[model samples]
Target: MTDTTTQKGDQMTDAPLLTDRATRLPAGSPDPAEDRSASTGLSVHGLRKTLGGRDVVAGIDLDVAPGELVSLLGPSGCGKTTTLRMVAGFLTADAGVVTMGDRDVTTLGPERRPSAMVFQNYALWPHMTVAQNVAFPLRTRRVPKAQTAERVRAALELVGLTHHATSKPTAISGGEQQRVALARAVVQEPDVLLLDEPLSNLDAKLRVGVRDEIRRIQQRLGITTVIVTHDQDEALSISDRIAVMHDGRIEQIATPAALYARPATLFVAGFIGSASTVAGRFLTGTPATVGADDTVLVRPEQVTLCEDSPLRATVARVLARGHFAEVVLAADDAELRAYVTGPPPAVGSETGVRLGEVLVYRDGLLAEVVR
Candidate 1:
């Protein structure tokens, strides 16, 4: 279950590699046979992979429109990175077709495909200067000196590393090193860009800034892109769309707003955002009380504290969360968490829990009980 063949160092937690050959980075210019049009899209159909006799990626199908940035968001061992590797041609699919635009690239090698990947560890050679690292892809193809130098300069400028072009990767900050990795990935002007947990190594504050820079660069390039990350915030902020994966399957895929507001499964509802699940029944009559068969998802930000309400609970804890206070309440043998802006009710005091916005499901998976 340990893969050392891929260039993305420690990028995939413990996924097994079927091959020992490392996926070589793209060299020189894009493939002339590969369409470099603005309309070129990336598609994967019926993709499946097995490692160590276990199915890691099971029948995954995804499509990314040109100029769109999509993220495969999932926790460890969920097969998100495995799927990305297959798309990048680092891992061959056990079953399925990977297509670029109208051509089937299911059997293509990593270097033959019109795609570039930014590795998790920033994969820059420690001995090379920033400009040299960015230009290495061109050098691999033996691109002319003038063209390589010009492309390297443009790539460095795109990632805002122009001033540090002569500096070795070890001389720069972690964030700068990441930008250099990005520059190297995009210097070839590939039709698609792949990012493998591209910001996992940065500090919390730096991740925010670097992620923004990535999104900005992606927009400017207008190339089809796929990013893999376990961080929901990173996925939500940088992606035009996100695919939530679990247990070797895609749970849901949608835009950030839609995914957050209307999660398709209980796993997604709970994973994409914070939620407190309370099991109760749907009242049939007017001003009805909660019954016992249904489960309700109450988002903290949607709940409010109000006086003179039918539903009551005991405040268990109160926490100040910068812009709002998190009030934890015990109600009907379930804990209800609410986010409010005003002073919170004292702990151990009785208060009313408001159901301002709630999603009720009849079954554990797919029945919509209420909106």
Candidate 2:
């Protein structure tokens, strides 16, 4: 792929001790004006895409502030990838206007846009050394060898892979390869950086570490970014805001805390965190989206478990979570879960469950919020 294209696969060498350093463009030969791309806001208005006669990406509108990292989060087949492709100019939108800063880029191809991408699969050339792979983009653009060398060294250093600059892609570890792909993308210093499930292939422990590194690098550089992922934890941890997509359109877009505290729809509430549902009425008054008979939902953290209550429930199950235990209680054909610390009640033991700050919903839309 050339500088114009977004990004592709890659791999890296085993890096037992990776260094985390301040990330910025390195000294190089390119003109100072063109080397550092200015941060810019991205806007997509009436974006639509249809695949196989189905509306994969329905009409959608989004605006991302300069240097903000927004995530397109949803389950598989929610059109997140399609929307990303449209934004990257890889897949032409059926209908919509895509603008970066003030320039309308709806008709531009991937090569013409000032953006970079990192794919899930580290697509690296097996024959080329890590340094060479990172330098390929500069080479394609006819950059001077001396400048390319300096830039590649800085890029590798930024990703903590400077020691493996000469190692072949096939010889590196998977995590190392991922860093190499990231180095390649960041070396260009594009205005926008797009990542698609960048950490899905790593182990749980490694995933956490890599995600932290990504967040650090993104913050230090302040490049406007959009990441696509299904992992709730990943999106919540790194994004400035998250856009929850469902059935091709954006369900809700808000900060992590706001999204979790007050979801706009039941789908968002259920999708973001674990919530137990029961038929009940809202003493807080019926909201615009709710009806007379509302469905109340409470998160496990909000549900308290005690050995006292007039209406008792039987402890049905208990799941040990490292720091706390999730206890499932059954009462009158209804089930609720509570997060309990210390010692949880034994199975079949009778206990009382009290809900705090409930969320009311009617017809799958949020009706009321206690807090």
Candidate 3:
């Protein structure tokens, strides 16, 4: 079940050639032509894992273009971290192949692979200074003393920690420690960088700062980066593309805007952003009629409230957000939420409800309609 090379035959085929020259396909077969091209910076093929007789990662495939920052996003135990670890060479896959550029490193150990990883705990040695920590990788590779110092200094500077080069991990801030971990990883100039929830330990105020810092550094280095995180905001804010995982399978992989606007699955629609589901049925190909069985997903921003719209609803509650007020409305056994930028509407007041860009789903699948 271990695939170690990329097969060149039939580029349009979804079947992947394993090390044993066997074709492995995922459940609910997806068209091979539909998968992203392998000209990608990183390609994962038929990744599968089992723990205690339970499939943890079931036949996952992904492609990350060169210099593309892709995020593996999902709730806890959704195999995001497990997939990251398999790519980093920390865990062996029960079935699959991992490729970086033109190299197949599926069986390669972490130290031997051309990739670096930043752990969630920062993994900084308390006794070592920032410079020494960053220099550890170069020293392991038997790099010249002068070159090691130069690379360490350059990495520290890249992360804006030049002033704290001699500082201990305890003396620096949490964000700074995270940077040190990043500096250490970048000093190696790895072909790919795997980040496992690197910002989860920071405070909310500091999270934004570190998030921006990481994105800036990644872009500056032009390194192929894959971040594993469960935070929707974190993935949406920085990733070029996001892979939404559910129960060890990728529900959808698309840009943030596409994922928010046209989700491929019901799980992705509910997981990636704030949404309210209302029962509805498709009146036509493009228009849907509210019903009791079908589920219609409406984003808060997609619902509009006006004084004279046709549909009337009673406001059940209003919660004020910074720039907008979230008003919950009940109409015909359907509960809808809307984001109003203006003043909050009075509770229990009758208001007109208008559907804005409604996305209809039936049987937990996206329904295509021609407008």
**Residue-wise C-alpha lDDT for candidate 3, range 45-76, written one tens digit per residue:** 99999988889999999998877899999999
Identify the runs in model 3 with alpha carbons over 4 angstroms from their true place.
1-40, 160-164, 167-176, 281-291, 368-371
Candidate 2 Cα deviation (angstroms), residue 129: 3.0
**Residue lDDT tens for model 2, 27-79:** 22133344444457889899999999999999989999988999999999999
User: What does the lDDT come to for candidate 2?
Assistant: 0.78
Q: Please give the CA lDDT of all the candidate structures.
A: 0.77, 0.78, 0.77
TM-score of each candidate structure, all chains considered together: 0.84, 0.84, 0.82
Candidate 3: give the clashing pairs: none
Each prediction's total of clashing residue pairs, residues at least 3 apart in sequence or on different chains, is 2, 14, 0
lDDT for model 1, on a 0 to 1 scale?
A: 0.77
Residue-level error in angstroms, candidate 3, position 283: 7.7
Q: Which ten contiguous residues of candidate 1 have the minimum total lDDT?
A: 15-24
- Count: clashes, candidate 2: 14
